[model samples]
Each structure stands twice: as C-alpha cells, then as structure tokens.
Target: MSEQPPSDCFICRKHRGEISIPGGAIYADDLVYVGHAQIREGQTIAYLGYLMVEPKRHVPDLAALTDEEARALMILVTRLSRALKATENAERVYLFVIGENVHHVHIHVVARYAGAPKEYWGARVDEWPAAPRGGTQEMEAICARLRVYLQKESG
Candidate 1:
C-alpha cells in the first residue's frame, strides 16, 4: 500500500496565512474554515481542516474521514447553504469538491443568482474578469452579517 501523505500539508500551511482572504472568513472550527467563496459573489468555501473530528490527523482523501466527520460537515454545509440563500437571496446553491490546486478534501457552496455574468455560468471556464476587489468596508459588513447568521444557527 502507498504510504500516507505528510501530516503537515500545504493546505494547512495556507490556512495558517500564506493565502489570506480579506473579509473572507466567516466561521471556523477545529475541523473546518467556513468562508466566502474566492471567485464568485455570495459563494462560500468550507475547508476541511483535518481528518479526525477531534484528534486532527492528516489524510489525503475523503475515505480517510470518519463517518461522523462526514456527517458533521454535511450539517455545517447545509446550515451555511441555507444561511446564504436566506441572507443573500440566492436563487440556487451549488456544492462541489474539485481540489485541483489545494489537494485537500473540502466543499464549495456557490450561491447562484439570476443574471450572474456569463463568465461564471459556463463549464468551459472563462477567466473571471478583473472586477474591483471588495474593499475592507464591504468585507466588514459581510463578516458582521454572516457572524450573526452563523451564531443564530449554532445557538
């Protein structure tokens, strides 16, 4: 059998700070980072932090995640999806895990809206236009609202 991957992976490093998302983080737990989607508006990405639900082991694939870990992740994803829809008034939500660069198991919750630009609608994948990055003020507003929503859900 192939040896297990390194315990300290690049994803963990990026989570530490190499890749920072401004106004990006909304919630986090020992096992996940729930934050705004990187490329799309109203999108959210939940990074599965570690393999174990508590012990926080490192693993290369979803099969390494325990059943309970999977279930808890599902619950959190569903809550975030619902919160996004209700808070953002999204038309629909998309969930995916295609880790081409990060090489870690995680989920994306994309809030699809009507009139979303063509660049975001296609499967062929066009380059996202260079729209102005959201400012600190915008991010602060989003973070505040998201925190309220998440706190309410968790209570």
Candidate 2:
C-alpha cells in the first residue's frame, strides 16, 4: 500500500498553536483536555499524548500505527484509565479510538458507572454520567475538581 502524504494535520495544528485550544478542555504537554460533555460528576476526557497511543495516527486504519506508537498508546491508555477510575469514582473506564468521522488519532477515556446504559458499553458510548446541563460555571467547577484529582494522583 502507498504511504499517505504529509498534510497539516488538525492535531498537529492544535499542538503548534496554529489553532485555538478547543473550549471545555485544558492542554498539557502530555495530554489534551477534553471537557466533559454530559457534565456528570467525575466525568472528563483526557486525550492521550501525540505519539499515536489510543487514537491511531495519520491514517484512519489501525494498521498504520508503528510498533512503538502502538506501545506508547497502550501505556497512555492504561495510565489514563486507572486515573479516571480512581479520581472519578468510576465503576468502569472505557477507551475508544474509533475515528470514522475525525481521522486524527485520539482516545476517549470515559468514566463509567454501575448504572451506565447498555448502549454505551464497549465502543458505542459517548455520553457522560447523569448530570444537569451545565454552562461555563459548571465546566470550570468540574475542570477544577479534575485538576485537583489529577494533581493528587500524580503526587
């Protein structure tokens, strides 16, 4: 198969500050902050590092990932999963890399609970735990809590 040509990838663009960081999330050198969609308690999205971890790289297919990229992605996945589970009090954690829409490599580290609906199981889930629709005030509060949780965990 022919190798894909290099283009200005979206992730790369965001990483280099060419694009504004997406709202509802924070950007760290090691991770991308994806804000909670459902605004549930202890639910958040922590995008793995840019080395092709959870989300496969450049190409949409998983086969495109190099051995090293795949390994790194797995490591990041495990780390994020454990962190979400502990900090969010999640009964289970879900890792997703389906890029049918956005082809960039990114993972959805969802914090799951006991009563989670069956539809969200496995690879078809995206909704956060039950929570009222929150605005900026709510988002900030959740982000702050997550920051604290992550800090404590790292320490």
The digit string of per-residue lDDT tens for model 2 on 40-106 reads 3473432211112333235555577677766666665565566556655567777667766556556
Per-residue lDDT of model 1, residues 39-131, tens digit only: 345543221110111113355456778877677678777777777676766555667666554445666665555555766753312233332
Query: For model 1, what is the alpha-carbon lDDT of residue 57?
Result: 37
Best by lDDT: 1
TM-scores of all candidate predictions against the true structure: 0.65, 0.59
**TM-score: which candidate is best?**
1
The C-alpha local distance difference test score for the whole of candidate 1 amounts to: 0.54
Off by over 4 Å in 2: 1-8, 22-59, 127-155
